[model samples]
Target: MINITLPDGSVKQVSKGSNALDLARQISEGLARNVLAAKVNGKVIDATLPLYEDAHLTLLTWNDPEGKSTMWHSSAHLMAEAIELLYPGVKFGIGPDIENGFYYDIDFCDYDISEKDFSKIEKKILELAKEKQTYQRKEVSKADALDYFSKKGDEYKLELIQDLEDGQITFYKSGQFTDLCRGPHIPNTGFIKAVKLTKVAGAYWRGDENRKQLTRIYGITFPKKKELTAYLEMLEEAKKRDHRVLGKELGLFTFSQKVGLGLPLWLPRGAVLREQLEQYLKRVQKEAGYEPVITPHIGNVNLYKTSGHYQKYGEESFKPIKTPVEGEEFFLKPMNCPHHCEIFNSSPHSYKELPIRYAEFGTVYRYEQSGELHGLTRVRGFTQDDAHIFCTPDQIKSEFNGVIDIVQQIFTAFNFNDVIIQISLRDPQHPEKYIGSDENWEKAENAIKEVAEERGLNAIVEYGEAAFYGPKMDFMVRDAIGRKWQLGTIQVDYNLPERFDLTYIGADNEKHRPVMIHRAPFGSMERFVAVLIEHCGGNFPLWLSPDQAIILPISEKYQNYAEKVLLLLKKHEIRTVIDDRSEKTGRKIRDAELKKIPYMLIVGEKEEASGSVSVRKHGEGDLGTFSIEDFAQKINSEVNKLINY
Candidate 1:
């Protein structure tokens, strides 16, 4: 008998070979039926994998994200199995689970695949799923793996095998299909009740443009048919809310060939929106005792080398610029921290002033592949709401707690109440992937976790997701349509200070190293604004709206009244605009509504007599007439409520 520790702190004495499925059955048959996978120690694995020694185990069900990922990954195998049956002699490339679903790349030698083939493929997938074929895993030697794929004439599989080590190889077989994978799959194909092949696209082999292009089939699966139906409906709604489409329709931002790809041009309205967001944060940062600073767009190449960013990210950075001063090369700044480090080095400091905070809205550049660039979300140029806090070891916790408060404050204003927090740490198995001393890493990681616990944040810990220089805390927020996005992040670093040789005189009059906290509540201005547009469907909050209200004259005779109302709104510090077009009242209102203006003030002969204006709210009918002062007061009340934080 061996000791197995369950998640609830219970120790069970079971046979050494007992699997997670067996343990779940012992607890309750219902749990066993729902168990899709299990987390053994810290790694996720199949529920059917046998235990060889004492271990810690947590059974994963459909409700868990890992469990859902396992199911989706297994569904990809099921789809491939169906394709293999329907069209023999088809070679497989790679199949992976994406954010929404699973997709498989296939090298169809002589068979043509397109959208017309999706229905039959989806039907065949459901048929194979009902057969309840068990997914089996097998550990194979490198030689055996090569021989198997070699006989099948699959160069893709052989190429993948070449990079992996001998003892780490594993293959999973489901139904009549077998593939090379390092997998934690669902128990059987029966877990998938509904299947949909969403689209067919072209993808180069291994994402290399020089390689042969293959047909990539995208798909999704659900445990219940009703869930699949709901997902399909959400997909339709998401299409309507897609940021790229909404950004263009709403005139927020755009890209041009002359301006270059992946670099967005903020239109007048979008520029105002971006400035408002920046001013909001600037106000909050000022209140938090942060000093604003600015840095140039380029930095000496040696600056990044000292901060260790160049060594880790040099390949992804643009080629360095050589100056007339030979051997003095500069690169468009890829990060702001290195320049900030030099700023700290410029002034000597003592422990009495340990926690010095500097903030900047710094623009950084990266070399992103043209294929990977989406709208503003995945851009080559972006500005970070970046800040760095240099604090003593004893002050680390309080500074971290304050950063959390800022993130919470930002979320409150945006009404983003649905947030998932994650504490990301380095992988213990791969120590070489990270920098910094073990002692410093332990201190930084402990400071973050302890602060989170003290603040009562139920943050999940994920290993192998940390930055190379430090551990980080990431905020994953769900948008209006239930899509998850990583918005804000806070990182604790001990490596950069040491690399830059930064120090402060301690209270004991001895030189000591200071801990660095790197934070960005908005992550990036472009990405945040993009998400905000999609979240509210282009109907912005009053304070952030491009045009708070538009004054429409009922007729050419009432133009004077409309102009008077607009002046009064502007005097009240409202973002007001005038619509003096020759169109009728109805056309003006319709145009204003389509522009997503928050309020429309209609001025006519009645307003000219009563000195009052009729107000119409966007997405709603008329809000009745009010004096100009009263309307401004109403707008002020709503905007003040949102900005009170």
Candidate 2:
């Protein structure tokens, strides 16, 4: 008998050859029926894979992320089968499950596919899914795999197999379709009761732009039709909340092909919104013992080389700018931490002066592919509300907790109550992919996990998701429409200090390395503002709105009184504007509503003399009339409630 430890810490003695499905059966039949996959000693595998030794097993159902991934992966195979049936002689590149769904890249020679074919493909997928074909995994030798695909005249599979070792190659076969895969697939296709092909796009063979562009089909699947229907509804809502659509509607930001793709031009209104967000964080950072600093947009090439960024991301970075002087090269700064590291190294320090927090709204540039660019969310240039805390190793946890508090405060103020925390760690198998000593890596990972637990955060741990330098914690906020966006991050690094040879004198008068804590509550000004616009549906909170209130004149008669009201509101520091255009009151109101202005103050002939203004709230309709002072006081109170320094 071998020992199998369940997630709840229960140890069960089972036969040596018992598979994960057998273990689930021992637990409960209902659990067995729901089990889509299993995690064996942290590695996800088929539920039917037999275990012959002591192992830690976690049975995965639809509720677990791994289970969902397995289901989606199986759905991809099912999709491939459907696509093959619909289009014969189609060669596939890769089909993997993504965050929301799965996508398959296919080289359909002389064949055309578009959104119009989505229904037929989705129908085919569902029809195959009902067939209840079991996904059977089979290991194949490199030569055998080559023979299989070569006989089928698929050069794509041949190219893939060329890099894979003989013993490591595996193929998964379901129904009449078979494909090479390293999988933890669902038990059967029947689990995918509903399927939807979401989009069709063009992708390079291996994401290399120079390679042949293939047709990429994106899709999503669910175990229940009702769930699929709800997901479609959410997709519709997400479309309405799309930042690109809202940005144009509210005149927040814009992109110009002439200026360049993936670069945003912040209009006046958008600039005001960004400035308000920055000022809000600036105030919070001041209270939290942070000193603001500024850095240049370009840095010496040697700076990145010394930070090891050049070694890892040199090719991805924009080519260095050359100068008249030989060997003089500079680059648009890709990150802020390296410059901050130089700042810390500028002077000597002692343990007493530890935890030096350097904050900057630093703008940086990256060379993002045009296809990947999406409004402000994925941009070539953006400013990060970045900071680096240089502290003693003993102070890491405390500093991390402090950063968490600030993040929570900012999210709460922005009404992002549904926050999901994710702890990303390095992959153990690929130790060379990361820098820093094993001891420091352990220290950083544990510090993050402990702080997350102590703070009682709703956090999930994911491996192989860490920055190449260190482990980190990221906060994903769900907007009003239930779409999640990564907003905040705190990374613990021990590599940079060692790279820069930064030191601080301890109580023993011995030189010690200061641990570095890199954090950004708002990942970037552009992305944060974009998310904010969508989250609030452009009806920004009183404190953050670019134009909180608009003064409307019933006619040319009350224009003076409208100006008077606006002056008073501006005196009270409310962001108010006057719609003095010679248009009907209804048209003005409709325009203001479309702009998502929070409040509209209408002054007519009677109100101009009575010293009162008619008030209307956006989306909520009229809130009756109030004296100018009363309205100003009400707006001030609401703003103060949302933003308190």
Candidate 3:
């Protein structure tokens, strides 16, 4: 018998060669039925894979993210099988599960496919799923893999196999379709009760722009049909809340092809909104003992070379600008940390002045692919709410905990109550991907882990998700509609300080390198505003609203009253606007609602005579009447309540 440790810390002695499904059966039949996969010693694998020795096992159901990933991976195979059956001689490149769904790239020979064919493909997938075909996994030699695909005349599979080693190659076969995969798949196709092919687009093979463009089909699946129905409803709601659509409707931001792709033009209202966010963060940083700094838009290429960023990300940066002098070149700044490091080195520091924190709202540029750019979320030019802290190694945890406090306050103020904290560490198998010594990496990684433990954060550790320089504490916040967005990040870096040759006079009268902490509560102004737009559906908090209230005159007769009311609100420092258009009162109210303004102050003869206004709240109409002074006090009270943090 071998000992299997369950997640609840229960040890069960079972027969050797028993798998996770068997263990689940021992626990409860219902659990076994729900089990889609299992995590063995931190690696997700098939529930049917037999265990040869003692192992730690965690049964994964639909509730677990890995279980969902396994189901989606299996559904991809099912999708490929369905498409292959429907359209013969179609060669596939790759299909993998993404955050929301799965997509497959296919080189369809002599056949044109589009979104119109999605229904038929989905129908075929469902039909094949009902067959309950078990997914069979087999290890194949590299030569055998190449020969099989060669016989099938698929160059994409051959190219993929050339990079893979002999013993590491594996193929998963379900129904009449088989493909190369390193898989942790579901038990059977029956787990996919519902399937939806969302989109079809052109994708270059292996993301190489110079290569052949193949048809890529995107899809999603669920175990139950009702769940799919609910997902579709949520998708419809998402469309309505999409920032690109609402940004234009609310006059927040825009883009133009003449200027450039992936660059946003912030309008007047949008600038005010962004400025408010910046001011709020500035106040918070001031209270936390942080000093502001500024950096240029361009930096000498050697600056990045010294910081190791150019070595890692040179290809993604915009082309360097060459001066009249042959060797002198400057590149658009890809990161702000390198410049900040130089600033720290410019002045000598002593141990008494350790823990220096520098903050900047620095704008940086990157050359993102045209196809990948999406409104404000993925932009070429964006500003980061970046800050760097230089402290002794012993103070790492306290500084990290302090940053976490600030992050929590920001999230609380924004109503992002549900957040997923991720502790990202380096991948042990690929040490070459990171800089710095093992000792430094260990110290940095341990600091974050200890901080998470001390803070009692229910965080998940994700291997290989760390930045190239160090480990990261990432915040994945769920929006009001349940969509997850990575909003904040804090990284511990010992590498950049070493590369920059930064040091401080220690208490022992010796020079020592100071550890660097890189943090951004709002990852980028563009992306944060995009997420905020979608999260609140453009109805910003009273404190952050571009125009907190708009005075709408009921008719031409109340135009004087509207201006007087606006002036009074302005005196109170409330962001207010006047709507003196000749349009009807109802039309003005409707337009104001569309803009998502927080409050509508309706002024008429009665309100003018009484020196008051009829107020209506967005999404909750009829807030009753209030005197002008009383309304100003009310708005200030609400803003104070939100900005108290």
Instruction: Kindly list the per-residue Cα lDDT of model 3 for residues 51-145, writing each as its tens digit.
Output: 98999999999999999999998988999999999999999999999988899999998998988899999999999999999888899999999
lDDT of 1: 0.91
Q: What TM-score would you give candidate 3 relative to the actual structure? A: 0.85
How many angstroms is residue 230 displaced in model 2 relative to the true structure, after the best TM-score fit? 3.8
Which scores better on lDDT, 2 or 3? 3
Stretches of candidate 2 above 4 Å error?
Answer: 1-74, 92-97, 123-194, 202-214, 222-229, 310-315, 322-327, 426-439, 463-465
lDDT of 2 by residue, 505-525 (tens): 999999999999999999999
What's the lDDT for residue 609 in model 2? 79
| Local error of candidate 1 at residue 125 (angstroms) | 3.2
Which residue pairs in model 1 clash with each other? Answer: none
**TM-scores for candidates 1 onward, in order:** 0.83, 0.82, 0.85
lDDT tens digits, residue span 1-645, model 1? 878899999988778888999999989999999999999998999999989899999899989889889999999899999999999988899999888789999999899998999999999999999999999999999999999999988888899999999999999999889899999999889999998898999999999989999999999898999999999898898888888988888788899999898999999989999999999999999999899999999999889889877888888889998888676889899889888999999989999987999999999999998889988899999999999999987787888889999999998899788889999999999989888888878888898899989888979999998988889999988889888889999998888899999999998999999989999999999999988887888889999998999999988899888888888999999999989999999999999999989999999988889999899999997999999999999999999998876
Q: Which pairs of residues collide in candidate 3?
A: none
**Better model by lDDT: candidate 1 vs candidate 3:** 3
